[model samples]
Target chain A: MRIKVKFHSLLRLYLGFGEMILELPDRQDITVRELIDELNLRVGKELKNKLLDGDEIKKGTMVLLNGKNILHLKKLDTVVQDGDVVVFFPPGGGG
Target chain B: MKSELSMFQRQIELLGTDCQSKIADTVILVAGIGGLGSVVAESLVRFGVQKIYIVDNGLIDAPDLNRQILYTYKDIGRPKVLVAKERLSSINPSCEIVPMDEKISESFELPNDVDGVADCLDNFADRFTLAELAWNKGIFLVHGGINGFWGQITSIVPNKSPKMKDLFAGVDEERQQVQVIMPTSGIVALLQSLEIVKLICGIEPNLIGKLLLIDLLNYDFDKIEV
Candidate 1:
């Protein structure tokens, strides 16, 4: 399955890349947590520390699956479909 | 007496009288007088947004001199909204400027006639408060934030877009001291002003239901659908 992941705001800077196309095992579905883990592994960055704390996304960071915030769905356990687009964005907290 | 159209002749010639009237008829509440608010309020005044209500209880600080254009070093320790009202009024004497020396909170009462809001507050807690207040009022809120070389902007319109609180659902309200270069705040605030202008002028703003991210470090700009 091919899943496209995008990074925006601070996450893009933290990950060192704006986008990545992940080719994972041909499973029917995978949770957003697994996708984040695989993405961190691919980038060799502990993105989880900056972006996630256990099942919850860290403060200031949001994980959107196909433009909808995953927190509104199933948090990290939300399933992702093939060809789905996920974005890791940390909205700026300052003015 | 100089006609209002003549004062905005340059812009009216381009956007036409219909757009000009819409801007004059709209009232915007700018919820901050710091970096983003400074530019947004100034821009709105210059754009002929005839009525503006600016709110902030912050006092000018030494650090603010770098980006808070409305206040100078001599104005440190003075209230931001008061200085902002003075500056904005000088720019457009005909424009009505109301200074509210207060912080946005659950108890803070938004002006009854406010038509839109500029979310230029320094922290997310107040941003959420101001956003929801505008939502309850069925008015649009243009949000802008800047840190370092990065910035983001979005517009939340009632019934037309998701709630800002929902979109930033996971955001913790803890305040942090954030760094912002002068230009980053200026750029973001100007865009926030433009978003409000477009919304007031009956033109579609690109930021509604979407986030526009700016990475001035790499000169990259991206818009992500929220």
Candidate 2:
């Protein structure tokens, strides 16, 4: 099983690469936090400081699973299934 | 040529008289008079949107002059809504510009005649409030925002499954003024204006349920499904 992770807006610009497909062998339930940790290991980029502040998503950061925002779900503890596409971005907030 | 034809000749040539008539008949609400709001209202006026209501409570600052085209150096320190109405009217006298000198608070009410709203607000709290109101009012909203070299545009129809507030939930307002450039704000606002025109003209809008994310630094434009 593979979960596709995508970055957008400022996150994409910061991460350089926009996408990563992580293989989760025989894994049925991986939380968003674990995914982020595995993602950092593969990419060798420390996104913890940038994506989160004290275990909560940074003020403007958005974590979406299959077009549904994580804030609507379970935050960092949201369960992820195989083949789910997770997206991240800090939305542009000015006019 | 007829007066209307000569006035909107170039636009009529491209969008056709049918589209032009729709633009002239629709009433729109521009929710801010800042960077994106200024450009959105200006383009809508040029597109021949005859009736519009502009809302803003901020006074123009020297910094706003960088991207807010509706106000000039001489117009600084004046109320944005008043300045915008005057400037928009100067561009097209046929446009009925109504300036609402107030903020988009929970008490704010969207007039029933407004066919669409341009969500050019700079902050998330008010944006969330306005989006909820527009959704409940069954009005279409063309949302645009800019920060630094990035800008985003999306259209939210009342019938759509996802509203702007839903997609942007939990996003806090910026502590300081957001960084925005002229071209980024202009481009995003113009795209939003185009979406408003498309919605008013009975044309299927491209950004409904999709977000047009733009990066001027790299010149990459991506339309992602929301």
Candidate 3:
């Protein structure tokens, strides 16, 4: 399956890239956690820690699927199918 | 362009014709012409607001191109308020577009004629300044903000209503940083415009005394009662 990933704000520094269209292992069903783990491995330990804490992704950062928010979905367990677009963003909060 | 009073025919049928006329006659001021303000202004004009005052000092830039929907590549170096006025005028020439090409500062003098204000500023300092100014002038202010997956929208009538500064109290201006996402910004702006119209129509707004929190990642729309 191919998923489009987007990175925003401070996370962009660690991601070393702004966005990417990548191929994920084809599974009948997948969770956000599973995908995060794979991204963690690809992004390396130091950068991953900046975005994730222990085994969980930080709450401050948001993950949106297509135009819908993942928080409205199942969170980490939000299932993904083919051609899903996932956007990761750490929004500026001062304004 | 016909009255389009018929476009509002359904709402008039529900709220009665008198209140609908009040909305059609109301004049609104939108403070800021960036990501959030631009959308709020456009939405209000689309809903048939009779007059709109757009305030801003910044010029369009590459970064703004991402979320500030009102401007395009040709607008890159132009003042935002002018572009906003041009675009909004094109959208609804029936509504008067008053362009105040200045930053909302502590010494700002709001026009005595406007009915309400929409706070779409990108910083807390300016927001507080505008809030104080509006409060002193007895204007109802609608506030909206978005950062990442979290966003909030609320309306304040100053001393008449629970003050927003009190609810989000003790906020340090220096440490505060705002991160914006396109979707959340657009959604919150729409909600702000809706609240403005409700106020114009003398209808009770949903976020009058509450903060609407939207976490897009989870798609959870939660309200925090103040």
Tens digits of per-residue lDDT for model 2, A1-95: 78989887778878897778889887877999888888877777788778888888888888888878898999999999988989887788898
Model 3 chain A weakest 10-residue run by lDDT: A86-95
Query: What is the descending lDDT order?
Result: 1, 2, 3
CA deviation > 4 Å runs, candidate 1:
B1-4
For model 2, what TM-score does chain A reach? Answer: 0.93
Provide per-model DockQ scores.
Answer: 0.75, 0.66, 0.11
lDDT tens per residue, model 1, A1-95: 88888887677777678888888776777899888787778888888788787767887787888889898999989999899999877777788
Candidate 2's C-alpha runs over 4 A off are: A25-29
TM-score: model 3 vs. ground truth? 0.68
Error of 1 at B220 (Å): 1.9
Q: List the candidate numbers ranked by TM-score, top first.
A: 1, 2, 3
Give the candidate number with the greatest DockQ.
1
B1-226 in candidate 3: lDDT tens per residue?
A: 4556656676667877777678777888898888888889999887878789899888998878877888999999999999998998887777789999898888899898878899888766687788888888888998876666566677888665556555444233332445666787788888888888788777774667665656666566655444
**DockQ (model 1, Cα):** 0.75
Error of 1 at A92 (Å): 0.9
Across all candidates, the chain A TM-score values are 0.91, 0.93, 0.82
Candidate 3 is graded, for docking, as: incorrect
